[model samples]
Target: MRLTLASYGLLTGIVLVVVVPFLVAVSYRAEQRQPDLSPERIIAASQGAFAPAIPPAEDLAVLELAAEQGIALAQNNLAVILLRTRDSRNHDRADRLLEAAAAQGLVQARYNIAYRIPYRFNTDPALVERQIDLLQRNVAADDIHSMALLAARLGFENRERFVEDRQAEQLALLQNAAATGDPDYLFLHGAELVDRVRNMPPSDHSPARLVVMELALEAFLASFEQGEPRAAQRISAMIAERNVGALTDRLAAMGLPTSDLEWLDMAGQAGLAYADCHYARKVLGDLWPDDLMTEPLYRISAGIVQDALTHPPERRQRALDLAEACATPPQIPEFRPRAFGHTALYLAKHRGGWPAIGDSRGQADVMLGVIAALGVFGPVDREKAAFHFDRAVRVHDYRGGVGFLDRLD
Candidate 1:
């Protein structure tokens, strides 16, 4: 009886040893959601909240395993990763994935043709021409955006043979885009008209010119009414550039309620004074080249651009003079130079801005402030410079130079 019990005990011990390990392995496998995600020779210390010191290999392995498991996002991510690798090894695969995403109408994929969507892509002459052809055929095709892009490309170009269609297309796209009230399109359309008028030929007095200008104004108004701050100032600029007939007279013809006559020259008052002959003439009329201007403001306050080489530079200067006339503020205070930039920063002086000034003098103050802010224009007068810089920074936010840092220094 004693011998039989001993034999049973030995058998039980063997079974326990084999079954324990098997049970532990099963439980471990069940607990794992993805992969073990471990690397050799890594130890953990204190970890931060929202941060984990997972091994790089472990993450890669888990993600790779997930992709193999047929996860959609993982698959998409893997496709992008392969494409971005920019290696001969994965380019074909990446291209296929990107195409697939594009086929799905993914917005990111739509933006992936090149890193940039505008001039960077359309600037290619062949590509733009092709897009124009496609748009001429259809705008709501699977690639309706082709028309949008083509119109956008030509807005600033103004090629002669295709002017009518391009303008029509541009108007359609801009109007459609405007319905959504997107500022970028408004700004782009405005900028394009400005460029076109700045380049139009003096002999090219087509009625289309006037229509395009009106379109630009109305477009700007739409955006302005939506609460863009610079709308009035930009319109004022357009007004000052016009030689359509006369400002007060033309606007008065409509018999609509309006602001003071003085405010008609708001852009000039805003300190965007000075003109090349072309723009100046349109803005200031006969006085565009210098003589002081009052009343009888140019009706079409937008400048029509002419060929730079066709018209002599002096003519351009004359035009600028007209525009400069628009800058005739009621009372512009002068300032001392050397008050800003290097002198102010390195010399440590408080030339102005010690106290706040109210609304009444704001216009003139701002005008002087503009002259001062654009310090590189004239002689260095510290006191005046400081006032200008201070005003520019405090009031208008010094937009002219803010972008300088982003430019190649």
Candidate 2:
């Protein structure tokens, strides 16, 4: 059966209409299953941990295809996946891809490279300027989102330079965002306003300043309560530094079952971040009862004071349990090798700086756990708790800039 020209034409049309769309659909489904190198992925990764909406294997296939197409954004995306994924298999290739995109003047690529540069990439002012410039190119294109970021970086750099006019510039960017109803802009702007009120000289304090302070506090509260952990942490730090009493009252008003002053462990294996806050001791002390603690047990938990009669004991057992359970650092999850590596960090800080617990590690849960374990199992040595505390202080500074990220001032 010899096919005629009409039959060939009909087949070609069929391939274009049916086959092409099918291939495209399959490719799209695959891409959707991986990080699409999209804005959402970038935001999620930068704001929190990298949670690939897609599986890493599937993401790799999509990234590989994007790389093959010579897409600049795709290359950058693939590089980020590779960098974060630590695909040793793709390390060299990912480096090349990033370099290629950076060569093409991709702003995100430049930012990524700048971030990855040695010494926090804060060394050369010129490098930072170049980064700002690349990022600004998009801002000038009316990328409103980029404008907010540019404003933030400019605020930081300008502060270093003592640029007098930056206050207006920062406000202007934020105002634009607010006018457009951008939640991201609101978070940053609200924080800035609060900072302005907080850092003002006492001489400048007035009724108007008080009003502004209230507004700033409200804005921060609004943003924080909406599940913005970074925002909440920032506001909490601000409140912690200033009025722990007031903040605790505010937390109480938020209707938490426990009082605001209590040391509620933040969820997960982060050993003592919750208790380290100033309000923790007071809150924990105010509510916990005394009698149930065994003498030896009573003596061990330093900050602990148990008395059922004097306090609303039943209401605060949850808080006490945290201290009891945290006698050791609980494992978080797979974020480990990093977890124990930081054992050195807690110990070092426990030594030269503020002890993660006290000047001695006896106050630290992990240290306490070690002491308790030794007493029970290994050697029943005297001052073993003190020894753990000392060892914690002597441990290497493993926690590299843990609290510094959201510590924007």
Candidate 3:
């Protein structure tokens, strides 16, 4: 009996000594073959290298692993990849991933989720509320983009039905965002102030409001200096309408550039279509260079004017007529679809006269379609509007879709 028990014990000891060591060796080798990815390397690749193409199978495995391990940036980047790839199922997963990152207080993740809600979530009431909540949270956390978006949305008069004291809160948020020195925020804040002044009754325009308007103009100038082209148009319009001397003095006091010509020159050089038109009309005395086109509309307008200049003296009147038609307003009207439609129709008739100027042609198409659909200048041609709108949307201009929706309601 003792001999039999010893034999069994010896067999157990042999198995432990041999099999256990073999298993441990295999485990160690597996770990050595696949080291954990470093956070820095993953982040860099996700931002640039992995963005242009699909990642290798092994790299995707590593990224998934990192995301599952609660790495917020990894989750956010993976979400971006899924969104780009764009399978319906993957998009839903991407939303979950964005939510996970937002849970970790990632402002960008929150912003992206809010931005996608209308398009991806079909403006679901629940999703819209979630977006508002996310924006509010980010605003409280002092996220600059969040502040700008929230303020802009709230500042619209339509928002008053939803949020109490929307205007005051919107103004405060704009001011907060402007303090960050971001060019976009500066322009938005300045625009909001301008709207406020424009909407107020003349009798109610106090010295305080005028002071705010001056500050807003200064903000616009600052934005222009920071490379915001829209600011140039704003400054040009204000100078053209208001007391230029007083406005210049106010701008100088605020350490902003006071010269309208300098501002126009800068904006024209920066490739703003409106600024180019203004500079050509004011400084060049309607004499546009043959190669002065930057935007498609500019190309059409400038091409017509240039073509007219080449006409014979006897037919110079025809050139002058076309040039007059090509003239853009000194102050761009906010909602002058009639004028825009006229220009658009003229451009459409002479489409072959201008050199093609890339995506600006697409923008012009969209604008013309919207104006025509709204019947702003002439009888509404829904069929023609649908054609242009479809073309614009095919090129990924969702604003065309918005115009369609606006007309629907």
Candidate 4:
């Protein structure tokens, strides 16, 4: 049994050659394999919750791995991320992932793929038709997102016949999704309700039509409550319509409680330009007090006049010229002194004023006259300013102010 040194060395060399490679291969494989690849683990890691002692993988890499392992959610999520890149290669991969996920009966994946191929851009009619078919299936399954998307795209793909089919189907889809409490859906639903009312037969006296109109109003109110700015404007328009048209009696008969003023206040608070401007006009309208000296408008005008008086003559004249330009009605609406003055005039012209100056421009003329007489924007011109005030007193029946004749002329 004695072995020679050469034979022993040859046996050791053979063992090293085989065993070392096998050990190295096993270590490499172990390093490459993940400790956990479950859907939860994949999602957690993607969201930055890493397992202890495991090397962190990029979110996309983890999702890709889980997707390849046939996790439908991972596939759908990965495809969503890929689709956002807008790269053609990524889009192709995303399409395949979406297809795979959809085939596994994921409702969102079906909608995602259908939404991805917008018929507007996709020239392939067959492909567009397929997407429509998929969307219709999802809609039938009561997928709210699919209903909204299909409602939008239904007529966009096909001919006039498809467009004609939109009225009932689109309205139904919008109405169904409206209760989902999504602001956009509520707005669309309100708009559809309005359209239905507009198309009602004129001679039809169905209480149901009034109910539908009331529903339209309700939808707009709900949308505004949900913080949609456009809804505020619509409500304002409705209020105006009620005030101007004979529909006021009709709508009021329905006991439709309109929050016209309340909605205007909210719209003003939310910084809507038109509503805010209207609010400013309302405030200014109430500003005609017994003592003009106590008014904020009077004080602001006095300060400007004081500032101009302190300047040297030439500089005062230049500043006065600029101030005069500023005093004119601004091309753009805003809440400034000029705006207050202009709005006073606008209200006096379009809406009747206090009973003393009823249906006349007297109140506005007096404001303008006083502004000019005090040199709020230019040199004090008693003669020029008195013209408007005196004319209002004589012609327009304005006796609110004593003409400030001594102060003016």
Candidate 5:
């Protein structure tokens, strides 16, 4: 019996020495094999947030693993990706993820949820209340995004039907957001101030109107200087209507663009496509130039484009000849389309004079057809355009559509 007990003790000792160390080593190796889910690592893997492009499969896998591991930021960003997909099932998952993130104190998730609510003067009472509540909470936390969003919601329209002091609240929020000197918020604040002055009674003769106008002008100028090109358009419009006295002098004094054309040019260079289009029309007319084309040929082609309708048959044919002579590879890619479109318009109108102008018109139509068919100009009809836009949206091309697509209708 003594020898058996001693044998058991010796076996127990051997088991502890071998099994415990084996278990410890296995645990250490398992931990070492686990991928890092640190904030920096997850953020680096996150994609499809600010960009139009979808994240690659590898990135999605990394994000999925991190999100599954309970990373709130990863969940929020993945929610954004799902929401952008616009699939109904994906939207449900996105909402759940956003709620989870918001529960974890992610303010951006709350702001995003509130931003999706449609504001129609409190037409939907439940949604309005929910949005207001969410935004108010976020605003209390001093979130600039929430402040701007809440301001927009409250000040949208029909304030009298809602809270009596909603306007004051909205203004306060705008002022707070604009105080941060963000160009977008500054522009919004300026627009709101302009609305205030417009709504005031004319006979009131309140010095407040002048003060508000001045403040708005300052906001617009600051916003424009900070890379908000639309603010320049606002200032130019105000100047054109003589809405603000001595606006041109003030602009000149500040070494800013004083003339309408000057403002348009500045805005154009700042990447406002509308301003660019208008400025190009004002400077170059409807005509577009080919690469390495001489200034004389450009001017003549522009004249032909503008005066094609009034020109005699012989002169029209001569103008077509000049245009053909001016044709070469397109220098300005943007102008290529307009050149083709305008040339086609001229050809269509001059069909009675030159029936054999097929080659010139055919080239233009070929280019225009390619552009139109590829959905650059949206669609050949409204129905197709809507479908194209809808598909583009579903594929996460909303921003790209707005930025790159032009609607013919």
Candidate 6:
């Protein structure tokens, strides 16, 4: 019981070291167990702080804490999670939370509210009007996505009410959105233009209408350049709609002469795969010179062809002769193999013979089968036709399936 002052101090120091560490560890564990509702923590968690590895439950705890304290971002995020849960009570709560966030002028929350109003909430006329008001506000704020969605909804879905009744306003909204050069908006604007062109009466087909259609095509090309995947399909459709004469006229209007291959070359260089195929076809038809021709030769041939059109019969033969002498065998165009293969199969089926250009073994066999079956290049030989058809079928040519079925019958 008789301890010296030095002994007492040593005992107290030892107790403090052990107790201090235990108390700190306990406090840290308690803090970790509870959700942190600090503004920084709420903002980070709202932005997916837990990320891919953590479960939703951990994220929900932190979000709930912040949302209960009226944090708009947290409210919006928690609303989204609740919406995904599919619980009826949570659905109502989520809608209320979204409305609360939107009332705070959160753009994303407004977008979500506008999107969900017609579908998730009952589509009352008042609610629809409210959603439209929010979308208009967002559009006025230069939110491009809202502009696109609103345009589609009003101009396409509720045309009679929102678009036809206010045509000029709707058009302005669509044009403004497209003017941003955003790929999605550009595609949508192009599509709307296509619809307008399609609906125009024959009597309405003036030069102005033609210019509008050309602008639509340019929009599609621009959208394709901006990485819109579906834009290529639209360009192909537009090309398919016009004949060579119409295309030539359009090119001439643009100050690009149709006598040369410049238009096709430009399109091909712009990543239009079908343009290369079309150019290859034109070369085979002698409508355009082969790519192997020297630039001077090409120009000379083009000039001769152009002159032949205006020349009298006596002079025309000489022009034709000069052009023919300048011509060379066509080379396979880059990016044309797949389209060429398909074209070869199409010619064999419809024209009764394959084009001498565009050679592929599978397509060649299909062509041979068709020729043999139809007596195109020789006497009909069903057995030989059947043999080629079988080979084509084995190679997964779906067209061969039709021939194989015919042979079996």
Q: Rank the candidates by lDDT, best first.
A: 5, 3, 4, 6, 2, 1
Clashes of each: 41, 12, 0, 0, 0, 0
Q: Which digits, one per residue and each the tens of the lDDT, describe model 4 over residues 286-347?
A: 21525454445557466545554654566444333332332233354432111001100100
Model 3 per-residue lDDT at 282: 48
After superposition, the stretches of candidate 5 with alpha carbons farther than 4 Å from their true spots are: 1-13, 56-71, 121-123, 159-162, 201-206, 279-409
Q: Note the residue pairs that clash in candidate 4.
A: none
- Which residue pairs collide in model 5, if any? none
lDDT of 2 by residue, 74-182 (tens): 6776665555455587667766876787778665565455444332324567765655665457556664554565566665543345335767777776666545544
Between candidates 4 and 6, name the one with more favorable lDDT. Answer: 4
User: What's the TM for model 6?
Assistant: 0.52
Given candidate 6, what's the lDDT at residue 251?
A: 48
Better of 2 and 6 by lDDT: 6
lDDT (0 to 1) per candidate: 0.42, 0.47, 0.60, 0.58, 0.60, 0.56
- TM-scores for all candidates? 0.38, 0.52, 0.60, 0.52, 0.64, 0.52
Candidate 3, pairs of clashing residues: none
lDDT string, candidate 1, 257-367, tens digits: 233222333323333242122243332222121211221212211212223234556754443344334323335544212111110011011111111222212223333
lDDT of 3 by residue, 1-409 (tens): 9999999999999989998899999999999987466776565446432334566766677668878988777777667666656379988987898889889987767776876755332345565567677889888887777777676555335555556788898888888988988777788888879888888786674777778778888788778778887777677667666534778777678786676655655665665654544443443133122222222444443544454355444444422222222232234444311100110010000000111233443444444454356453358777766766676556534342334524344
User: Candidate 4 at 71: error in angstroms?
Assistant: 2.0
Error of 5 at 379 (Å): 34
Which model scores highest in TM-score? 5
